[model samples]
Target: MDAVADHGGSLGRASALFPQAPLPWIDLSTGINPHSYPLFDLPATAFSRLPEPARERTLAEVAAATYGAPSAANVVSAPGTQILLPRVAAAVKPGRALVLGPTYAEHARACAIAGHTVAEVRDFDALFSADIAIVVNPNNPDGRVARRRDLLELADKMRSKGGLLVVDEAFMEVGPLDERMDGDVGRGGLVVLRSFGKFFGLAGVRLGFAIAAESLAARIHGELGPWAVAGPALEYGIKALGDDAWQQAMRERLAADAARLDALFADSGVEVGGGTSLFRYVKLPDAPALFETLGQQGILIRNFIWDETALRVGLPGSEAEWRRLEQALAAWATRRQERAMEAQP
Candidate 1:
């Protein structure tokens, strides 16, 4: 297989290599919501490969509306954010870019693929002081969000130096859709990439978009070619965009689910570090052990190998799933306590 296993809780690759286990694992490593927007209502005609003008208009309008784009120039759709990242790197040709540390590794990977020297802003000062910054809003893995004003200031500095500021807003819509840094994109050097995968549960559908000024949008679109999105992706993308009711309900449910995740961690002595409504990043004394324990119980979660001491886990959809995770954590805690007791003087 040509695929890389970089994501949290990707057992499919492993399953392909080895004999599959009996009980299927509940994958929580992905920051995506377990309660997905229903796609059953998508038009039967969506499967056709014909150029869908109405579908295209709906996608463009709905995406633009959701992001509160200052102008139609602000929105460009993609198969998913993954493909768009490479396209943006190709279009912008940014060199000496600084990626926020411990972010989605794919950002750096994309920059590297584009032949850019990707330096990580590791120290606190570099993070606050980088001239060109690619900050992932509600960052991946660790889940920390940068302050808005600080981010704006960074963008301004980058613009002054003729550098670009790219932010991955993939998880931003999980909270307030309006919290997007829309006004800043027109400042000439800023772009925000949003994903339809996480919040809308459209990961398999591969829908994502970018918000940029007209010039930049045109340039990026040119590099990406016309009609980069598939027929099913484009059709569903429009339907997904036009549906505000689903977005509202998802937000409300995720907020509640996030609260429950916090409580579960607090009760079990696992310190959840940061996340808004969609996912939570946590630090446990023994994240690998916890990951194994949870995995054995068929409750798969995200654990960063680079930081073996921390893990990221997503909240489940229903109360039953939540209860299952809660019980698994309780059992894991008891095991830890027993191990500690064994080592006591």
Candidate 2:
């Protein structure tokens, strides 16, 4: 089961693994906002027509403003950042690729797909030697952050040698704002990937962006050609990205929820590891046990294939969901305490 566990948001696999678990499971897998943006009415033309070029440009402008890019020219909107991974990796001719590790698995996979000799490296300095280097800002699951100065220095070094540095800012909405590299992509050799679905809670929308210098941005745009984004995605991106008031309020709300989750974990005797507001990281010796307990209770979270003592649990949506999680933890806590006592000589 550990080896087969792939990406998050897969209830089908969860059901298959734990067939006796309750129905209507609580999924806390991906770092997606549970309190999603309110669905709005879309015009009939959205589904009936091919996306308009003007709407694409408008979406780019909105993304540029929302993500702090220099201009719309520096942004290339795509269906999702997942699809753009290979496109960005293929920007420079295939060579060696280094991804900062124990992070998202897709970066290494995408680089390999682009015909690069991909390696996941622990040392930040080792990235400088690769033809393509990748980093996940406020890194996934662990929330490890890289210094802005260090990243910029690396970008400069990569640019000097015609290499590329790809920064995935998928979690930056709730991350440390000071270490953001979104504004520095204008200097070249750096391409920043931003996900609309994670922050806005619209993963089904399939919208994301790549920010880079004009030339590189144009290269990605050329590969995408026309109508890369759905009309509904353009509509949502325009409305959601433009709504700063909602974004600010949601950030505050998510912060409070994350704090509540941390307290719940601590009270239940599980010390939380670092994570962004959207998810909480847990490093426990008995992670598989906790996973089994929660999965039996119909609550599925993220577990890593590479690390046995790792789990990534996202925020629950409502009060009932919260209570369910609390109850599940209470049971796990009692069981853990009994096991500890029995093991004591």
Candidate 3:
């Protein structure tokens, strides 16, 4: 099979492929929140001048509280988690890097690009002696979460060897609170990466944070230099991170939306394997056909190259989009039934 698209949210590419498809595409390709944070007007200085140090400090403080990070000293801001991944990989001297398999591809890619010998392992046992170990908690595309105790154990082992354990909790916001490791960062060699865009639905703002020990965070901050996060991103992030009421409401909403998505898949005769509130993972024998059919209907989702039988479906933003997805799934089911009948002897 050809390589699955490296990432999702590529409506432009989808449109190019299916020129005759309808407009106003219903994009559920990425795990980004559909219900975005309400944007507010910003001061002219937010656009005219460089981001104030005070604003940056405030954002970090808010992020620390939101992430339950140990302290502001442990938080480092960046343009996006994507930008920080490779930088963090490079900052840690290239060595034996072990990544929890079939998770985010970027972790291995970043390590390899930084000259580390990267290996994909299936279990935590393999991480004990590795110079670096990376995991995506509530693993993307499948939402498999490693227990916090296991992760802390691995981190302790790696720390003993003067190694690092990097956990990408990009989707953890939609997961259980106890599964997070942000507050555990002071354990000497644990680093937690948080994405501001996925949960808040502001990918365009390009903001993310890394929570680690003060020394490591300072290293990352120095590498990022001054004003790594844009002014607008700083302003927006400060507000969004500070809004506890909104966060609580969004969690409940996303959980309900995920259940709705699961029901849709079940009714369509698709089997849901696992996933977080933001997306569901389906295992179908004809996953490629389903992906193509949905794309033809101007509905895009995520498919993994390593697992051809798996397709990741994100939640629809509105009721209209939900109806569209339901109709498309109904059509797919009908076609499958017709194909089954034709194959009968």
Candidate 4:
């Protein structure tokens, strides 16, 4: 497992790294939705008071319904998915932990933090050997999905051995519905993590949930303790998660945006390998140069430390932002062409 580097949405670091670049940088580092869920006025108590127990329960119920968890008892709320990573890993005692990669680096680091010897395996079959096996559904960076039936079989194997199977379904909001393991967590030996911020475009709200059997859910909830979530976060999460109409509309919009992005990349002669609608993964020899070009032009996309040739580009927010991205890619393409011509005999 590699030490954690900047994990996207790093405009401050980007500003310092590219000091001379333009102002108001376009940050498309993470897979967060560019068009955020609508915000509204909150009651004064929601800000001045600790989140009421009833409100918290309501939020949990809403989350459970939204994510298709069996019930509110199976869902544990947290400040963010990142906070739940180590807790999820710690649910099982330290042992041989295997993470399916190249995915989110935090999973491996979290397992190590939980006192496990962490190994990242690319093959699905290889994961069956570990005491703790982690799979990111519709995996990050690349949208490779393990089938639901395959995952259930793997979970059954791990469960039989008293091991844990962790499925990070953070991107599943935009991924295949049938492939999600949220509904199966009640079968035991599995934990499904759902991220609200990515789909709702409310990362700043710091909301995430873990779905598992009631006992495991309780254990993870105990780790969080009372009032783990903030007042503003509770308000935003409750209102947004329950709004089914908004989510459906947003999903459709994101699909359209993803198609537009694919077309845009194709015109620039870049191939999109795979990614959820919220982001697109581009793996190319010139990915490094493209990353630099975007950064230098005040547009920041996510680049990887482990895979030098891989970059993740998120959706552009507005028409202006889209045009800017287009212009930046055009500039990079021109520079690339000029270099190719220079090498010609």
Candidate 5:
């Protein structure tokens, strides 16, 4: 991971790095929703305040309800999970933090930056022995949700070791809200982080929440400065969260799209890991070339250079976009097959 190199998708500097024949690229780099919540055009005054107390209360309440963290006192708001992640690391400052690997990049980054000894638990085998566990429910990239009973048992085992279990539930909203990790939430050393921007499609607002045991919550709140969330975001998030109908529709639509995308990519000889409705991680032989090829076709998707063999494609704009992707992928697969033949005697 170069410090200043663009990795993939729309903003990747790879386009600028090879500008001779610039491709019209579509970005699937981020797992964020392509369709956004209806913005009401917030008032200028809404952002003028450093912190609007009333707005904070409302946003917290709505977030609590949305995340099933009905106990308001345990919730702390931040601009985004990215911001809260490092903050949680700093607050906990554990001697050792165990993070489930092949998941979000930010989790490892957060712990490393905080100077905590970090260990990656690769799978259930490792997780069974992992003393302190941090995981993303409905894990990122793969969208693999751990069995509820297994995860709860793991959390208990970790707690008994005097360790913390942090679960990032950012994409859990893609499924039924009830499927959230509400179990064992208030247990000592158990922290759950959620992002409002994902399911609500309000990334620009940069809103996220931290739920923990009361003592831990107070510690994190005290460490993070006052008025952490801006007034406008606070107001907007509350309204968006209150719209249960919208969230439900978004889930149903994404489920349909995920199914459609799985079928489309299957035609390209790619297998989708996990059960995500927002994005599908397609396993391919050469991700970098596949990414560039897709860019040349005006299709943008996420490819991790380090992985170099997995492409995470997001939901297409419409059925037309899906068709476009499917067609381009089919052609690419033909070319790949031709190349494979060429490599043969």
Candidate 6:
């Protein structure tokens, strides 16, 4: 397997690489929510002055309630989970790190950057052997969810060795509630990372949270310093987190969209691996070729270097985007058939 890219959502890179492909690219390369949360006009102070500590407190309170965290003190807000990954790794002394893999590449990268000897392991039992272990629940690109019981058990084992279990629940909002470990933050060395942007479709807001015991949360908070969250992010995050109705509706919408995407892939003769509502993972020998084909048509989906057969397709926001994707998939099917015919003996 080749080295995986650090992250996705590079529209500029796509445009530069495929300049002649098309204009107004339809990006399905990330798991970010297609239908973003509605925004409203912000108060002048949201930009002119520093964010009020009271507003930041309200944001944490809302986040704690929204994520079912133990308490507001246990929830430390950050600009985004990506920034906190390394911060969390740094807070803990450098030690053996095992990142459950073929998942997000950042966990291992962060750990290694923090000066830990990092290894990507496929087995859950590897958790017992490391000082810090990271698992992306509803695992990225593939959405393989580890059982809550298994996670708790592993956390307990790691705790006995004075280790930490970092569970990245970036997509868990679209998954089952029982699979979440946020409420277990203070128990047996568990830390939960939640992304506000992925579920809310406001990636540019740059907001995320770390739910842990107060001591560890304080360590992360201190490292981040004051004003870790932006003024507008604090304002918007409070509203979005408290809006239970919108969250519920968005969940239903994402579920339907995911099912529709799955059916579309199946109809186009693509074999889908497991996935959550945010994205579907397709495993095909021609994934790289398909990725290029889709890019040529200005349809950008995520392709993996770690596994050449894997492609991650996110939901299209509007009807026109859906039709565009459908047409592109049909074109791919037609081209595949032509290749098959040419190879026939």
Highest-scoring model, lDDT: 2
By TM-score, is 4 or 6 better? Answer: 4
Instruction: List ranges where model 4 is wrong by over 4 Å.
Output: 1-3
Q: TM-score for model 6? A: 0.97
Cα displacement (Å) at residue 212, model 5: 1.0
* Deviation (Å) of 320 in candidate 2: 0.9
lDDT of 3 by residue, 1-345 (tens): 233358888888889877877879988889999999998999988889999889999999999999999899999999999888877787668899999878888888888888899999988788887899998998987899989999999889878878889999999999878989999999887999999999999989999999999999999999899989889999999999999999999999999999999999889888788999999988889999999999899899988888898899899999999999999999999999999999999
Error of 5 at 337 (Å): 3.7
Which of the two, 3 or 5, has more TM-score? 3
The C-alpha TM-scores of every prediction are: 0.91, 0.98, 0.97, 0.97, 0.89, 0.97
- What candidate 2 gets wrong by more than 4 Å, as runs, is 1-5
Q: Give RMSD (Å) of candidate 5 vs. truth.
A: 2.7
| Residues 1-345, model 2: lDDT tens digits | 122247889999999889999878999988999999989999999999999999999998988988889999999999999899989999989899999998988888888888999899999999999999999998997999999999999999999999999999999999988888889999999999999999899999999999999999998999999889999999999999999999999999999999999999999998888999999999999999999999999999999988989999999999999999999999999999999999999
Overall local distance difference test of candidate 4? 0.92
Model 6 agreement with the true structure over 1-345: per-residue lDDT tens digits: 234465668898898778888878999999999999998999999999988888888998999998899889999999999899988877668999998888888888888888899999999887788899999998997889999999999889877888889999999999878989999988858899999999999999999999998999998899888888999999889999999999999999999999999899889898778888999988988888899998999988898777888889999999999999999999999999899999999
Clashing pairs in 4: none
Off by over 4 Å in 6: 1-5
Q: TM-score of predicted model 5? A: 0.89
Candidate 5: minimum summed lDDT over ten consecutive residues — where?
Answer: 1-10
Q: lDDT (CA) for every model shown?
A: 0.75, 0.93, 0.90, 0.92, 0.75, 0.89
Q: Quote model 3's TM-score.
A: 0.97
